[model samples]
Target: MGKNVNFTLLTMLYLFIYIVASPNSTIDKNALLAFKAQITSNPNKILAKNWSQETPFCNWIWIGITCGKRHQRVRGLNLANMGLGGIIAKEIDGLSFLRSLIISENSFYGFFPDEMGNLSQLQEIEM
Candidate 1:
């Protein structure tokens, strides 16, 4: 009985650690989806056709997304001149590892989300 109790406790500890330490790619994916949700117009259907849960967000490099080599985190986003128009989503800040963002030459309206300031790793932004 004592051995079983100890084993159960140890198993529970490991599961807790795994849940706490594991990186969640969903956060970045959801953030991107939130941004997509705000897009009023995507003339080329680039995002509409590509940005879906069926494909991993890290695999979206062709559509102006860049992911970190070491992890699945988004590092850069270049949505320039794709004829996209919409408000920027406040959830954009969920991309904690984002380093560069370029959305220039587009028709995006509304104030930029204040939540973007939460991106500590952000180094460059062009709007």
Candidate 2:
């Protein structure tokens, strides 16, 4: 009987740790959604069904978005060859954990957003 009580306590501890360790990714989700909204055309309809408020960003079917190691923050965005066209939104700068940005082979126009410089963790950007 004592052993059973000890096991229950351990299990509860584990659950508490898991919940506390998980990072809230509200800002990252909002930023990505903002960028998705700016997309004027999507021939493949990639972001149509996948990127939605009803779904979790991590579970979205977008091939470009990537979550980070510790937290589930936006770590990478690769939109290459997606046939997407429109001006890039500055909201991307809100991805504080972003390390990579790939938007090659698309029809994105206009000057790059100056806010991109705020991405201190950005290591590579393929345009």
Which candidate leads the pack in lDDT? 1
Runs with alpha carbons beyond 4 Å of true place in candidate 1: 1-23, 60-62
Q: What lDDT does the true structure give each of the candidates?
A: 0.88, 0.83
lDDT of 2 at 38: 89
RMSD of each: 4.8, 3.0
Per-residue lDDT of candidate 2, residues 1-127 (tens digit): 9999999999998888667644446677778888989899899998886787777776545568888666667889999999999877898888989999899998888988999889999999888
The lDDT of model 1 is: 0.88
lDDT of 1 by residue, 7-44 (tens): 99999998876576345577888899999999999999
Over 4 Å off, model 2? 1-24
> TM-scores of the models, in the given order?
0.80, 0.80
Candidate 2, overall lDDT? 0.83
